[model samples]
Target: MAVRSHSTRVQSFSLSGYHGKPTRGTVTIREFNREQRMRRALEGLGKWWGVALLSVFIPVAHFVLVPSFLLYGMWQLCQRLGTAELATDAHGACPDCGTEQTFELAPRWRAPQPVTCKQCHRGLRLTVPS
Candidate 1:
């Protein structure tokens, strides 16, 4: 009987659709809208006189609710146009330096190749199991 040793090496890995983990900075449309609504409500309460005056013509509730909904709609449009802050995942740390270097992943990228390390400024490559 003869024994043979074989090794396989994968040079590149697909980073396509790499929706890596979402970080705290990532914002969803719903979250954004919620925050905006809260801010508007707080402002209306702070300037109680203005709100009371506005309530004469239109309900104070409508004054705050209408604009917030309009802004939310605008934000949704911008999100569809890829211009708004969305829940986008980011890449992990550098393999070489192990430093906290945050980077946005491209739509498509090949991994496990020599990429310049942001922290060390040296060629670094990360291998993934095939």
Candidate 2:
């Protein structure tokens, strides 16, 4: 009997033609300016507006906006309640093992989902609080 490990697994591929032939082509590497990259990205937006907008704009906007919103919301909340010790994050705790974990905003907005607990290795249902 033999035991196989994932690390030791072999990955093989083949080509139908195995002849002594010269197949060489020039490889060109062209670097684009920031504006060119942006133009190319927007060009992709023409194909799938929703996907391109969501994928490209969301992250860039989030990095520039989420932190600002979170900070301002925290500041206002703290001022209203007159408390300094406070923290806010989109997260849920593992019910089985009581391990807390943060979640992304988009998925958590949809519905409750099962998340694996790092501590007990059990599946726990997590939902964002309204």
- Clashes (backbone N, CA, C under 3 Å), per candidate, total 0, 0
Task: Tell me each candidate's TM-score.
Answer: 0.26, 0.25
| Best candidate (score: lDDT) | 1
The alpha-carbon lDDT assigned to residue 5 of candidate 2 equals 23
User: Model 1 off-target regions past 4 Å?
Assistant: 1-90, 104-107
Specify the poorest-scoring 10-residue window by lDDT in model 2. Answer: 8-17
Candidate 1 local distance difference test against the native? 0.40
What would the per-residue lDDT of candidate 1 be over residues 6-121, giving only the tens digit for each residue?
22222322221123432121111122234444454455444554444555566557777656555555554443343222223334455445555544433222334344446667
| Deviation (Å) of 21 in candidate 2 | 69
State the displacement of the C-alpha of residue 45, model 1, in Å, after optimal TM-score superposition.
48
Instruction: State each model's C-alpha RMSD to the native.
Output: 17.6, 24.2
Which clashing pairs does model 1 show? none
- Scored by CA lDDT, what does every candidate get? 0.40, 0.37
